[model samples]
Target: MSDATQNDERSQGVSRRGFVAGTGAVLGAAAIGGLGLPAQASAAEAATAASIDNGARVPVLIIGTGYGGSVTALRLAQAGVDVHMVEMGMAWDTPGSDGKIFAHTTKPDGRSFWLRTKTKQPLSNFLGFPIDQDIPKYTGILDAEEFSGITVYQGRGVGGGSLVNGGMAVTPKRENFSSVLPSVDVDEMYNTYYPRANAGLGVTNVDQRWWESANCYQYARVGRKHAERSGFPFVFVPNVYDWEYMKAEEAGTVPKSAVAGEILYGNNYGKKSLQKTYIAQAKATGKVTISTLHKVTSVSPAASGGGYTVAIDQINTSGDTVATKTVTADRVFFAAGSVGTTKLLVRLKATGALPNLSSEVGKGWGENGNVMCGRANHMWDATGKVQSSIPTAGIDNWAAGGAFAEVAPLPTGIETYASFYLSITKNPHRAEFTYNAATGKVDLNWQTAWKQDSINMAKSIFDKINKKEGTIYRTDLFGTYKIWGDHLTYHPLGGVVLNKATDNYGRLNGYQGLYVMDGSLIPGNATVNPFVTITALAERNIDKIITADLGR
Candidate 1:
């Protein structure tokens, strides 16, 4: 490995100037190739969907412009088929009141945040509203009334969860993938879809020089030393951010900062949200059309050949009156993440709007047993900013017959001294979501049956970290140890799952034209970031649909 690569492995923080200078040195050759495609496309050009067949209307209408939705749109458009996408959030533009292009934290004032207000009885914010409000609205998936105490951050702009999620791009361990998708050939899927998705999204490891100065790296080093002392191995994580930008930060060409630490809030810089990736490429195809701020209310069986008619409520940007529009499509793909897809399908099933819905519309929910842990160091060294770079290492104990654990650097900002942290503890948790018949809302009732496994995993990893001779500081227990039935990371999976609700290929089990391609199609928690999996599955499903022997 090069010095920069060695530095990254060692967990060194890089300055912004160092980052930029390193990027210029390393990326100059690669940038000369096709790297200019994304930059050549303006923000507007990147966000707009490409045009499909001009002679005929599209055969498919994808709802939501998220990871799954955008991927499906891109594949279909590439196949020369017409595709239209409807999104409930606004297009990503200049930063609004916050002075940032994206938002990571919720504003106290309701003006900037998104809330759920779709029902007569106004829901509370804890259930999942960005801001507390009494008005009836569709506040993403969480029950705003019940989750009032929790901060459930769901992105409402063009890219959906991709805009707000940590850019951690990890493939699930082989066992996890096999358990959830036993029928599909895991090796084939990985070989085919994994590289395709990564290429499309620009996945790369953090430049070593950047990690040389990053606070996250310092923390990782601490964790690694502790793990070594405890006989545990240190693992590096791969992410979906522009490593070039990271190098720029290290070289001081760019600001020694990130889109901002509220990664789950939103990244104004550094991170590559879907809006900047698949969505951007799909728009470049000139065949997809995306209508933002338009929410789909219902879908019904069209009188035509196994098609469907979608009812959407278009929210006026300037006024209160909502206009409804009915659009027809030969196929409808639901790629609105896990919660959004499940809620939509559940509501439709309950209301008899799409009576042919299968019995397994809403069930088998899992959270990939997500737990965030960290260790605090006593030293007061000025490590580089944490948010500007991504984690470069991970632990594979969980994947290799050992407890599931992955450690990475946590960006706690400068000045505050801290060591490495891990979003570790990767045992798949079994949870279920129930639709309340009386209220027409989905309630997530999670039980901690896998508590022992999770605790064991944490203890083993912590012990390993502590045993490392080079370790600094003790592993300090921080947030989210209680494992309450609280809302955690937004990587929700299952519910409207595959094989059961849909056919082996994601076609609705009973309905002819209905399809689902979002995280919901994932049979279980990924134990890693879910976006790449979701996108790859979307591609796989679209390919199966287009190649089917069924006459078009």
Candidate 2:
């Protein structure tokens, strides 16, 4: 099959059955997530065969299918707008030879890292030995994008970061909301958008009673014990994982996902990713279409037309560009997460494609004050061998220590006597993405030394815990004798910040129909897991944009 046809099929095939079963002719929201095979597969295929033909114009074009993109597409499609979303990754709908769509965390293959020859596991070492191994370069799920100083780990697929994240859907505390997005109306978000985003994303808390005794959560319990002993609050954070399904997995009544250590790359089941929530609903609207493996390379104003001309490159599994296509859109939404959107916008401004874009486009980028470390739990406090990858609780030291650390799992399939944590601190350093004209690429000026602030902030929490527990830090997780994992960030925020690079409602300052509706809008930190904020802010921005801009 032609690449365009394959891209179109992968984009719509998984949800086609659900769509057909709901509305007969088009997809419907209630049935698109996991409906069985379409009653009329051939007809559904024919109906969705309208691939990205060159020169075709769409009502709206969205770049990326992450949380922001998914939310924007769903809402716009509901408002009778035809949206074409272009994603730079695979559909991830087809199972591999192992009869699984996603590879397990411990046994990663070509299905793990995006276009890389070697696996870049966040935990680079184990038991004083390097764990990364060579693999065939493929368009995999996780993209450990390297810059000057940091490796930003982002998810690449039709569902975007939702495919690989731990599903820790945390809304910032009401009082801290002002610092997260100062320009936004506090009451509107707290009372309306946050709840809408949480409900739409299927966020729920784990049964605390069950968590107290679950074997898989022994790691979290150890973490809680240490935090409580250190006088820090141990809080249960809500996640997008289906708690009941996880209970069934523990009971051996269903196929295991979280309990089987199915995170990092992707979760095969139970986790409510965008594909199972927003993207599914968008496809069900019958007004939204997608093209996978099609990366947007340029977005310039059309010489003759009123909308923007988007140039896309269709790539293969080996990351080779086979075809380039150009299409026009009446409006465009930059929902490519923080790193992707920032890089694109920065490059566009420098290369003269969108020269009118303000300098603020590339400023105010941050790593969300992310730092990771592991604790050496005493032999008496053994974290279980069979651990759940879906994290459910965290240590809240944000008030005193400037850190909120999630009790992450070390699912090495063995009792490692380790308590892992990913801490989001209150580091105030902001970086910038600059265009490297010499290299014809974008570079982030985020120095490795800048992470010292984050390390110091994180130390405020772990130091007290280690002292209270009379334990030392684990040195084998990140590297040999390395105490802090400060070289990477899973949460990349800002660049095209709200009310800075764009108007109050995400409309680009100089471009009328161009907008940013992603993590790029948040100025650096969300004080918790950023996806819930990304989804909620997108919900708020798109609602205002549609009402004022779209002639609905």
Candidate 3:
């Protein structure tokens, strides 16, 4: 595979030295904390501040602080509605004993888990050896929440998924969007909400000039080289990480994050997560307040017809409940992600907390058909010695098959000529979450074999590339040499399906003041990365709700 055969973007780029030297002097001399956030007090101070106002009766209440929750809270607050959000996670703005907001992926500790004594790395192995370690249990960022047939990874903090993700902000293709979410108004999403969300989230594409020469993107270039050889189109995926800060890190100027292999944990700097974007803006409105470490256990119609009575538990970092309180809300929005919201709704319906919840409450759920596999490239490919953990490109073969695979980064900080990919495919194996009354738990009826369709869809792209590049699957990753990770998902979407479980705009079918506003409202799966869609949908729904329902 030669550079001559690739596109002009790949063939014509700055030299490696130019990438570093171009920004080295300029960024190195600039003030640190270029985002204007105070240096040491951000995480801890933010957490402490959000913990104020333990209980309140507000006009609007949001559960969880991810995209949906943050977006809804911000919009309602902007409309002069007093908003209170209850989050089960800790506030991530506080630094730990290490004086760091989060731990590094390569050197995970107490700051990497939710409350378990052991750390669960998404890439649990390297070269077929288990790489996880046992650490002291504490409240942490990334959560590998386990269930029967799957381990769903979620971020635990004020920013939700934004606290710990690859920061790949992607919207589903326009033509495919209709199938993924049939009830959504197409034009409103693409023309209004998507652009609005993108601008608010600070999503941007990598500069072609810098990507060509930067050592961090060498791994992406390798993936692009292989995809082109296999007749696949490599599309540039936008991200929330700041390009300037990334360049500064590569130039040895600002503190390193994405370029330093900090992902799936938390970025200490430069990533415009929800806490830095929507939630921060929401707080600025002064009408919105948040209570951290408070989980909404149940919500029932208030004796007075105008509101809901909510049950909450306030817990400490060690998962010890210190207080249980009740709060009333005029309107309640379930913004906990698909799993969390689904679990709450299912248990609420099954246990008689809210007996009138629709039967469709927990009917539709899927893993977004997520699967991971890697290819062992030839030494000549030379995926650089220093690789950026942030991915910038993907193999888009959705027309030929039902798969969109991102060219992921290894970021081992050493040359291995390895090609990595995390794929999202169309596997129609949706599961249902049934509440177990005896155990008071929510059970998902999903089987391991259910993922074979996803595996087959993903293999369609990799098989062609492997044959074209004369490479083979790496036996070390996921498990044995040729096996793929078929039982986990970082993108768990759907549960309370749209239009069926709720109205077109997320109003719960059976309740007047209740709504489902998170990824749970999405039916089954999204064709691409889901955060962008979640943000746009929240914006659209809240726009209608504010105009028609809530009065200032």
For every candidate in turn, the CA RMSD to the true structure comes to 10.2, 12.5, 7.1
TM-score of 2: 0.91
lDDT of 3 by residue, 395-442 (tens): 998878889998998766555556778999998988899998788789
**Top-lDDT candidate index:** 2
Question: Where in model 3 is the C-alpha error above 4 Å?
Answer: 1-55
lDDT of 1: 0.59
Compare candidates 1 and 2 on TM-score and give the better one: 2
Error of 1 at 489 (Å): 2.7
* Order by TM-score, highest first: 2, 3, 1
- Backbone clash total, candidate 3: 5
What are the runs in model 2 whose C-alpha is more than 4 Å off?
Answer: 1-50
- The residue pairs that clash in candidate 3, if any, are 43-93, 43-94, 44-93, 44-94, 475-481
TM-score versus the correct structure, for each prediction: 0.76, 0.91, 0.90
RMSD of 3: 7.1
lDDT digits (tens) for residues 430-536 of candidate 2? 99999999999999999999899889988999889877776677776677789899999999999999999998889998989999999999998888989999999
Instruction: Give lDDT per model, in order.
Output: 0.59, 0.86, 0.81
- Minimum summed lDDT over a 10-residue window in model 3 is located at 29-38
